[model samples]
Target: MLRLLKVLILLPITAILVVFAVSNRQSAVVSLWPLPYEIATPVFFLVLAPLILGVLLGGAAAWLAGGKSRRLARERARQIRTLEKAATTLPAVLS
Candidate 1:
């Protein structure tokens, strides 16, 4: 089911990207203003670089934002383990 969903979503996007890349085959000059750096590349590359970068950066930001939540969950899990251990020992001691 998950594989089907992935295929459904990715197929159209892959098709669209293929079409875009083919349509934009012309060399585009990408220049960094201020310093002398330039490269001639395809237009799709220019679009995808920032896109991939944004995805990576956004993922990092989300992970960083969830740090506290992750820590709390870990502490809760440890607490649950300790309580369970205590409960087990209490029953043995009562017997």
Candidate 2:
């Protein structure tokens, strides 16, 4: 099911990229940023920018989520350990 969704998504993306590549074969100077870095070939940016941004954003989001998940797991484990220690000592204290 997941694979089917991935294939469906990629089909349109592949088509769009093919069209973008065909349309942007010419070398056009793109000065959208504060610091203008020239792309000798427009096709490179057309294909690469989104891929790079996707990877960067995915990595950042994953890193943030991973930290939170790790923290939560550690806290849960700590609570469990404390509870177990208390349970082991309760009979000794009562006696």
Candidate 3:
């Protein structure tokens, strides 16, 4: 199911990239170096910059969040086990 969803989401992006790559012969007006520049629209960063930055940011955030949650879960499980052991031993010790 996730694979299908991934394909569906990526299909349009793949199509757009292919279209841009193939249609790069024409130029468009763009800004560069503190001025509006005329460059090949499909050949420019408009086709790549955001994708790169988004991937980097998304990867970093996922890593950071996943690490924290995994650590918290481990700590919670350890605490639960410690409490259970203490509870089980206390009755025998008191008797």
Off by over 4 Å in 3: 25-42, 76-95
User: Which candidate model has the greater lDDT, 1 or 2?
Assistant: 1
Instruction: Count clashing pairs, candidate 1.
Output: 0
Checking candidate 3 for backbone clashes, the offending pairs are none
Reference-based lDDT, residue 17, model 1: 83
lDDT of each: 0.93, 0.85, 0.82
Q: Write the per-residue lDDT of candidate 3 for residues 1-95, one digit (tens) a residue.
A: 99999999999988987777677745565767676665556454575778889999999999997997899999999999999999999999999
Ranked candidates, highest TM-score first: 1, 3, 2
lDDT for model 2: 0.85
Q: Judged by lDDT against the true structure, how good is candidate 1?
A: 0.93
lDDT tens digits by residue: candidate 1, 39-71:
899998888779889989999999999999999
Better of 1 and 3 by lDDT: 1
lDDT by residue (1-95, candidate 2, tens digit) is 99999999999988987787777777766665777675465765766788979989999999997998899999999999999999999999999
The most accurate candidate by lDDT is 1
Point out where model 2 deviates above 4 Å.
Answer: 30-39, 43-51, 70-95
TM-scores for all candidates: the values are 0.82, 0.49, 0.50
Q: Tell me the spans in candidate 1 whose CA falls farther than 4 Å from its real position.
A: 1-7
